[model samples]
Target: MTCTEEAKAELPSDARPEIKAYLENFNSYDTIFIGYPNWWGTMPMCMFTLLDKLDIILYNKT
Candidate 1:
């Protein structure tokens, strides 16, 4: 199952489409620099989701 499908299952009707579109275009960057302050001994879920959705093939080929 893709992230879009999984995200849709968790989110409500209105937000699913935008979230899916973000994930689909998430791989457009060649290199991403994620800078986030650790809060309560944990990074944000959004960062993890971005990393999880990125395509590894772009790095491997370069």
Candidate 2:
């Protein structure tokens, strides 16, 4: 489940825990692919927002 920003603003802090919990279940896959088109040599602001909002450790096992 990927989350996209519908509005150009930060999401509420409460949304983080739920997203972290969801990413924690990613082990069910053998490989996870995160693709993004290069924008000014960086990912879109939305991807960074998603990354910063989640717990990296939960996804570290993969």
Candidate 3:
């Protein structure tokens, strides 16, 4: 799939979900895996949506 220049430039907040699901507590784990197909040298918009929802950044991971 291809995205327009506007979509690519948009922030994660503009991402839309294709399905409804609950995300587990992020603080409960030290490692989180995010998988997505490479589209135009960037991840799909859905991945950005999930990342945007996260309130904390994982730094100094063990």
Candidate 4:
């Protein structure tokens, strides 16, 4: 839907998208699932951002 790299996640940013309140219980789950449409042989930039942030969150807690 976009033809530019200026979009988020394509580039890292301090801003993070809002998460659902129910998802606050993230650690309660034993398994996590991720789904995204394949775009140009890469995941959407938002996935990159989410995964990057998730990694940081996981790292900080442990």
The sequence of per-residue lDDT tens digits that candidate 1 reaches over residues 1-62 is 68546554444422312225453444576666779766335544455554555545344446
Best by TM-score: 4
Ranking by TM-score: 4, 3, 2, 1
lDDT of candidate model 1 versus the reference: 0.49
**Consecutive 10-residue window with the lowest summed lDDT within model 4:** 14-23
- Which ten-residue region of model 1 has the weakest summed lDDT? 10-19
Clashing pairs in 1: none
C-alpha RMSD by candidate, in order:
9.4, 7.3, 6.0, 4.6
Off by over 4 Å in 2: 1-24, 53-62
Q: Estimate each model's TM-score.
A: 0.39, 0.40, 0.53, 0.57
Q: Over 4 Å off in model 4, which ranges?
A: 1-22
| Residue ranges of candidate 3 with Cα displaced over 4 Å | 1-14, 56-62
lDDT for each candidate structure: 0.49, 0.49, 0.62, 0.61
Q: Over 4 Å off in model 1, which ranges? A: 1-28, 55-62
Q: Pick by lDDT: which candidate is best?
A: 3
* 1-62 per-residue lDDT for model 4 (tens digits): 35454544444554344434324655566788999978557676667667776676666686
lDDT of 2 at 36: 81
- Clash pairs, candidate 4, are none
What's the C-alpha lDDT at position 26 in model 2?
53
Tens digits of per-residue lDDT, candidate 2, 1-62, equal 13344222334422322233435555466766778866445665656656664446444556
